[model samples]
Target chain A: MIKRGYWDIDDILADEEPIMVQVTKTIKGAGFLNPESGELDLNEHTRFTIPLWLAENMATRELAKIELPKIFGESYLNILEADPRIISLKDRSNYFFEVATKLNDFLQDGKFITPLQKVFVARFVHLYNEITHNSDPKIIKKLTELERDIYEKGMKTTREFFDWRERKFDIIRSAQHVVNNAKRFKLK
Target chain B: MENEITLPESEFFAENTKITIIPNFKHAGFQILSGFYGPLRPSVAIEVPLWLGVFLKRQQKCRIIPPAWMDLQVLKDKFEEERKKEEFSELDFYYMEVSSLLLAHAKEDIPNHVLICRLIQDLQDLRTSKIRNSLQKITVENLYANFKDIASIELQAIRRLLPATYDSIDYMRKTENND
Candidate 1:
């Protein structure tokens, strides 16, 4: 999901998501990665949890094979498939969709691709219809980071329309950053 | 790709649309960047840009004539057509902006402006539901959607969301595991 060396903060943060992989070949001088065990080298056939970025690299080189996380397992996917609109995806993972996208690439089965599209489309449709009246904080709490970005963008358009309807058009406004920056400079 | 038009920008462009206005002041040609309009005479109705009409109307110097589509009977018939058809009924590209501007600045000038305002709002609500219905059709296998006959101002409402959603969908469908 992340392009290594790209200037994407979200990608960088998403790359930090820990993933599980089984070592096919022992890696030397890497025992420090697993802080729980005081070992000198990573042993062969040991199941290890590593960040997404490293796991992909190791798996591609035949040094390890990735195992789908519990969230990507059949039971969780079945829950997502049953009703996508009501689930609190944020509780499961902040970068749920982003990590899923990356995971789909490793899975040549095209496993996560269909469910990703299905979940996004179903939740997106529900968000579109009811977002204008989304005053309740509970609705936003259910959204993951990607979904939150979409919600905020859609909400901005609705707010602009409502402001225009209320005839608040003639006022000159300050940029959002300017307003926020001003507060920091204020003396206590 | 044509740049996405924002709400205020769309309203600003709609201000350039011409409307008929009856002035109470006599004046020779008033020149503006857009061109020469003018020779204003008392009680004489003449066509002018909506912005100029609203400006003069605010100063109590002229009376604005509501656009033809604002008539109650006309709107009622149009609403009926909108209900019967799956496609959006053709409306003036600037209908949303024009009606909002007229209703805000020259309320007294438009006959039965209250009923006209309500009708316009109801029509907008109907069209919005139609948009939501079409958006549900978007899926990974069938991404191409034919959104035809939508007006400029109405298009502005969903401009940001639609394209951004499509882009996200493209991102999700990334195939090359290499790059």
Candidate 2:
């Protein structure tokens, strides 16, 4: 899970600090293969990096409404068998980031986030996760710079933010600050 | 060398040699004491105006500290020191930082309702403290009042001073022109 600050609703919950949300590279199950024609029926599974935040009120009763039609509605109908809250945050802040659409109201409202903005969000998410989970400061400046870059670029999306995340995580275990913090939080 | 000095060597040397001694002494022993001057060099390096540093760091991704060796304890201490230095600067540079983050990442408008709501709530708490007229007290009211005022005024102005958006292509163009 990726949290950007203390105000995150999960900060108040049980072991919700470094909430784990696997941002894995998806596999499309099948890909086209052909040597002679050099053409096959395969689409690369899209990679996703989702920063799951906190549950708003922490009850399934209201989640059905808060996360329904507006958030994962159509998708909810299909994934309903899996439980909608699994992907949605039933919180008041209206946070939602599904990699495939990375286009929810959050990212599409603006022109587009620059690569720098993408990296910045990734850095901040990692920082917040760390502060929540580990309480480290070494990455604070990086987080601040990342935040500044995003503001300078207007804003970014979940996909753009995550695209930079996997890369930034690989580039700098800076995000590990959050992972480390998560450990500390769990110990407490 | 002593005999030459006794002979008064060159007139130019006689005059300049004495003057150069100060710098030499400084380079030798005095500079060591400078270390006690509060890690000023690192302070200055990190204290560089936020916008300028961010712009450069983004371009030279690997130029800043390699994340692997980043130390949070050190960073926290430094930030604490810097905050102490700027305690009376009339700007919540830090909170503006928070506002900036909300603006940059939220998938929606610049005002960012969630962050704005948070900001407004914080400000309201500060306003309550203002009404009490006891700013010296360490309370959320005082902290928020000062933080909110700083955010609305100084930070707002600074935000306006920066570009509303940046593009890698434009950055490349600027770099190419410099070369």
Candidate 1: DockQ? 0.44
What DockQ values do the models have?
A: 0.44, 0.03
What does the lDDT read for residue B173 in candidate 1?
Answer: 68
Model 1's A-chain: what TM-score? 0.89
Q: Candidate 2 on A82-168: residue-level lDDT in tens?
A: 432122232312222221112222223222222223332333333323432334334333322223333332222222223332333
- Pick the DockQ winner: 1
Query: In terms of docking quality, how is candidate 1 classified?
Result: acceptable
lDDT for each residue of candidate 1 in A1-188, tens digit (9 for 90 to 100): 22324788888888889998888888898888776567888888888799999999988999889999888778898999899989999888888878887787666656666787878878887787666455665688998777787787788788888888776876788977898899889953
Q: Give the TM-score comparing model 1 with the true structure, all chains together.
A: 0.88
Local accuracy by lDDT, each model: 0.82, 0.29
Query: Which TM-score values does chain B get in all models?
Result: 0.90, 0.21
Report how far off residue A72 is in candidate 1 (Å).
2.3
What TM-score does each prediction get for chain A alone? 0.89, 0.18
